[model samples]
Target chain A: MAGVRAAVVGTGLIGGSLLLRLRDAGLDVTGWDPDPVARGHVRRWGVACPDAVEAAVTGRDAVFLCGPLPTLSGMLARVAAATPEHCVLTDVGSTKAEVAATATASGLGHRFVPGHPMAGADRAGPAAADPGLLVGAAWVLCPGPNGLASFRRLAALLIEVFEARVVPMSAPEHDAAAALSSHVPHLLAGALAGAVQRSTLRDAVLSLAAGSFTDGTRVAGGPPQRTANMLLGNRDRVLSGLASVRAMLDELADALRAADAGTLTDRLAEGRAARATLGERRFDTHQREFPAPADHAGELDYLRALGAAGGHLTGCRTAGGAVTYTGQLPHTPDPA
Target chain B: MAGVRAAVVGTGLIGGSLLLRLRDAGLDVTGWDPDPVARGHVRRWGVACPDAVEAAVTGRDAVFLCGPLPTLSGMLARVAAATPEHCVLTDVGSTKAEVAATATASGLGHRFVPGHPMAGADRAGPAAADPGLLVGAAWVLCPGPNGLASFRRLAALLIEVFEARVVPMSAPEHDAAAALSSHVPHLLAGALAGAVQRSTLRDAVLSLAAGSFTDGTRVAGGPPQRTANMLLGNRDRVLSGLASVRAMLDELADALRAADAGTLTDRLAEGRAARATLGERRFDTHQREFPAPADHAGELDYLRALGAAGGHLTGCRTAGGAVTYTGQLPHTPDPA
Candidate 1:
């Protein structure tokens, strides 16, 4: 592993983060970015700043194409034609089918490990990279029969270096799952934000928006082209996810229109249960209910106490001047 | 405000929280709940627990109807018939229009102040109440002409006691805004969660779901009946909001189908800008990028360094076996 020479193309958030992790893992790493500023920045960080993609790819143990989809496809072609037989190629991209097809066409499908790290940020560029970004995140690898051995090696390296969980699956499965987890969520965020922008009291309403609205639309803050590209690239799955969402909404809408409280409550309960299952993986780990004090100052003190207990107050209510609070208790499961 | 003797009918989250806040502010508060357990909890907390709604309402200077839509409507009728003329009534409900109409029909329009607090939790019940739940949150007050003076006094009291921002507006205006800011978002959360639950790789994909998905569906975790009541009660505005969201999705779908990156980019950018504007009110106030170092142990140290600098490592990359990190600096704006 110490002698493993790896190269990263595109020094943006994902690429930059990968490069940093690789360097920290004590790999012989080379970095190439189309942007000279990015290249210079990596150079100053002590990475072997390559002047050309070919220079970074030549004789490398692994070459990770970290650019946009088109850039990665082009680099795959270049590596397939010129890189040494031992230079296992890979990529960190959202979509897999197209990339897999390109790698297969290049006769390097077996050697090309198609991967996607389920981690990102609103910002981009090498300067936004973090070695810890992918830690504890899922790293999906779409492996073809041709490069099964290489994919295994790459997966092992990823686990050891990035401390990421390697989930191996087919390209189609990866795409389908991603549509639900990432692609559709991005579209939903945009649509919700768009509705807000179109509201009659847009500014006033937005001013009143709290944690729910903000959290619901957090992904919409990402770069326009990046979001659009991911959504379009995974079109089929995105459409499928959207259809499911639309159908659910229609059900809720119909229930509301009919004033059918029973049906509405049933559907809402189903959703609430589903959300609770997912809630376990939230930023806060454990949730518990406690007695909240019936006073503003006491409430503040209660919040501080929760924080000191490695938790934070998430909800509060009062009845007859007696207050209660809900908070996430770290490392502790709810007795109920 | 201290001399105010207020009665709360329905000792639930909103009602309970309000009762606690009012009592903490030195008001004489009485609470009544159909559920004996809830009434007992508040009674033990020192609130005068009345056994009957009429008993709680009679002779009180203010009567806050804190219940579901139907309960609130029913209480308004009873209050109109039994409460003293000087008793100013108010309600905490999601939909203002129907509540206002009901109050008007009951001949208590001037006395009833329709309010909607823009704060909530996934859990409900009197046990979930927090005195500080509404602190720093927006509380919309829809006052009829007859209750203008009373509304002003109530607004002042809410501001002082609960530390809530009182936004005075018409009932219709309040409903429309809530549709965009609260109601629609709640429905959207359910729809998204439902979609995830219905996906082919439901469990697997959800396991990979990150902050975006979790945050996006946070509100869907609330009790089903509560969410259904709110959405169904505000049918018209909810429908309008849903229509807006559907149209936006349609546009995005068309662009994605056509592979029209330009249109998709434009829409996404629009969303991004809108989210940026709303982001100012976010609890997280600082975002700065810092340099990360190379090496496993050093990587941890880098994170500590960033933390010490009031920042956290967000991104990292490596070149030539040397690592670099990116992190957000506290109170510093991100420089592109």
Candidate 2:
């Protein structure tokens, strides 16, 4: 670990943050970005900013290609040609099968380990680089043939240095799973948001938008070209994912059209149960108990007062003539 | 608003919350719920808990039918039967067209004002009643013939007492808009979540689930019956929305299958722009300026440390081998 030298090509958010993460972990890291401004910022971080990509990777122990997916293969070839024979080459591309294929054809497969970290921010570029960006995020590893040792080493580095959760899978498996877990969701959000954007009553709909709309559409705000590149790179898997989604929507539509309460209820219940397990954690909630009221109107008053005071009833029970109500307080502090 | 006597039927989250909202606004409210536990909560709140639905509406200035959509017409009929001649009747049903039609057929159209509050909580029942739930939420009002006067009165109550945004639209318009805004998004969430639930790799997929997945699935976790009721009540509009959604998804799928980068990028960009307008207001971020660094690696290190220390770079410049970075500081306090 002490003598590890890493070079990051492309200083966008992922590349930039990765360079900093390596440096902060006490590794000798050099970075290169085509943009002068991005390159300059990387230099200011106390890490070397080589004048050329070749100079940056010449003697590196590990070389990371974090360029746009479309240009990854070229960058990988160039970086591989410049680096030492033992220097392991890897990438942070969202897609993998193509990269694996390219590396195999180029005879660099043995030295290549494909990886895709499940993390990002709304912002982009080297300036947005943050070592903690990858913290607690899932980093999927898809090692190519004869690259197991390198994959293990890189996996160790990601976990120990970046504090990422390492998930191992084949390149095809990664692509398939990502299609379901990430790619299709983004496409759906984009589609839904796009549909709304084209509507004549867009403003009216937006005015009535709530947390549900905002949350569902959040990922649709990603950079256009970048999103499109990911979708195209994993075209086959994405198409498959889209098929599954279409089938699900069709079933829902059928149930709705038929007014099949039983089917609708079953689907909704299943969804509720599934979503409940996704996060596995939530912020601690504040709770309070209030005394019972004299009648329905009184109970309403108590609830309103609590709500006005930024609380919500979680539970309530009556004993004798009095009732006790428990509720969760608002997360945000009351306005001063 | 003083001396206005109101009666509420059904004591689920919405009904219970509404009763509380009115009573807290200094109105005398009586309530009745078939569920003994729900009725018990109303009684404990200090508001009159009438044993019979008729007793609750007998002398009220306004009667709110807050029961399920299927039972709404029945409750409206009963309330209308017992209500005084001048009593105004309103409802908090999610769908307006059906309810409006029912009221018209019942010969109580003039006295009925169909309203739907775009608000809710994850939980349900009287125990989950929240007064501030409607605060700042859009409350769509579809006033009937003589219901205009009462609609105005109720709108004022909603605005002044509950701090809700009153939006007026025809019953048909309300249904159409709601189908797009709430009902369909909800169904989409349920469908997506359900798809994941039925997957063999549900656990793995859920484990890798990110903010996009969680946000898109949030509404799917709502009570199944409640969700089904809303969807069914707005069946025709919901079906239209579903058709639109399906068409959008199909277009996206076609683009993916054809590997049309241009089309995909255009759609993604369109979605991003539209989503940008959904939340009109956002917190003003804070920016900070820091001196530049001598090398790219150093700058990266600096940026990461700043991010770790809760900050973000907004801009950077280099002069004479040195660089300066401008960034936004983190909004929250650093953890000890």
Candidate 3:
């Protein structure tokens, strides 16, 4: 679609990345941004910079409006004023109900399609944008039956350029899913961090926060406005998601309070398997597991046998005398 | 002190890391691990491998037991059998109450220091062990008043190599703090994953799981055996931690269910500021952010203004025309 003309509004990470990818794919892409710095940055990122909206939107086949949810409607109103009746309008926003409602109220219902790129970074602004950032990511397209063809076509183009898979669903379903998957999780991470910061050891523990804590709260620290809009705009679903998470905490509390090693073991086992499944996603694609050497297996077996025999061992060290894995004492441990 | 012999009782990550650091500081250090593979790996990782516990412990002036909770007491018993009368013993575990109890009950309390290394990884075994992993970490040293001097000496040695801050506290306090900081969070992550797995979009949504979801649930998917032992080992503390977390979640739910945007924003903002404090740790002293062209910032700002203007913007073919950020047209977003 080198001949395809596309205009991207917002020019932030999601929209900016999409525009950059389109230009790289050799499509005719014009970026329109009121912020001179944003415009200059897009041009530097290699997208064609347009001087005016008419030069960018009038004849283009498609346009993507991706910005703060609060700014979308106002931008969409401008898009309506300049674009022709056939120009396809699409958005990359986390929430659907409000955007869709506002559009319907404004009578731009016929030519718009709602889409959300399920991928984002903790960083924002144009500098954080990457041409291929959305590649291999999932993009959900919410379109009515009448608008499916055009939306699918746009999604297909996205797939070719960004390597993103398109999952089509109803708007409410998309909102609900996002509310649970993204909005509520961010809120929870933030809340967790907040609670921990209240502890006396906040400085001590937070300093030692490893990959788990970092990753757990990564989104919590990212673009505040985006998260807020997603939560309040999708209030119903987000609240329900919060409820779901609370229920989970309740179950875990019950299990831990019960102090049944069996149950704890079972839960941990389940979580272990689930994380393995999750690791298949892009983030942990390069995860490495360093299992103990095969030779260690033999040593373990031999030690077990030694214990079984009349021979009791005090402790056995490895060859270099620095590594240790077990403690075999002559006496049995007391039941705690 | 430099001439003293030291025995490291379990060749796991913490144990192995400590042994290497001690010996590198000029102390005579020997390791005791029965699992041959771990022994080999730890040796390869630069730990001194000892062949027998009695040989390793007989003359050692200091010993650190680093292993699973179930094995701590048993190891202490063996140390009692062969260790010199002045040998000071310690442990590296997540929770401390159990270790303190075991050490006291095993008849080795007077000679042992029940301690815990607050640093570790999601992965375990000798290979996953890093020699400098505990460098700059927090090592909680909990001991009865009688063993304070020996324990502080041990901690002082760690400070030279690992640069870890030695925080002194009672075993119960250490365990309670750990429950709040670590165990409860792990349980929450696992439970969140479990909840999603049980939701209506279990297959669809999880299949579309991205970095955020993977991150949010990372703690849930840690080692099964370790998690189980850690959670149930200090059952009361973990349960109390669960209560604390539950209360926080409930507060969030109420705020959301009530459509209190102000409360949500406050929570999100607080989390954002607190998470920012993470940068204070300076753990990644060796790494830096990838540099980008300096001019990109100015250009990005320009684009924001264009998107904000109410205008019809489409594609590159309409070059010279700019699409602005504006509140003019209605984008017909697909309804749910």
TM-score of chain A of 1: 0.81
Q: Between candidates 1 and 3, which one is better according to TM-score?
A: 1
Say which docking band candidate 3 falls in.
incorrect
Give the distance in Å from residue A182's predicted Cα in candidate 3 to where it truly belongs: 1.7
> Cα miss at A92, model 2 (Å)?
2.6
Interface RMSD of each: 8.4, 9.9, 12.3
For all predicted structures, in order, the TM-scores are 0.78, 0.77, 0.74
Native contact recovery (fnat) for each candidate is 0.67, 0.69, 0.50
Model 3 interface DockQ: 0.20
User: Best to worst by TM-score, what's the order?
Assistant: 1, 2, 3
Tens digits of per-residue lDDT for model 3 on A232-280?
Answer: 7788888777677667666666767777667666766665665665555
Can you write out model 3's per-residue Cα lDDT over B76-169, one digit (the tens) per residue? 7887788777778888877777778777776666678767666667677766666678776656666564554454356556665566655555
For B222-292, candidate 2 gives per-residue lDDT tens digits of 89999999999999988987677667777777887888889978878888888776544322244323333
**lDDT by residue for model 1 over A1-336, one digit each (tens)?**
788989888888999999998999899998988989999999999988878878877888888888987567877888666678878888989989889988898788768989888899888888889989987676777767556557546866776687665555567777887887788888888988987877657765675577677877889998888888888788988898788888988888898889899998887777777777666644353333333232433333444344333232333334454444445444545699
**Reference-based lDDT, each prediction:** 0.75, 0.74, 0.66
Q: What is the Cα-based TM-score of model 3?
A: 0.74
Candidate 3 has an lDDT of: 0.66
Off by over 4 Å in 1: A1-5, A21-30, A43-48, A56-60, A79-84, A280-336, B1-7, B21-30, B43-48, B54-61, B79-84, B280-336
Local error of candidate 1 at residue B305 (angstroms): 49
TM-score of chain A of each: 0.81, 0.81, 0.77
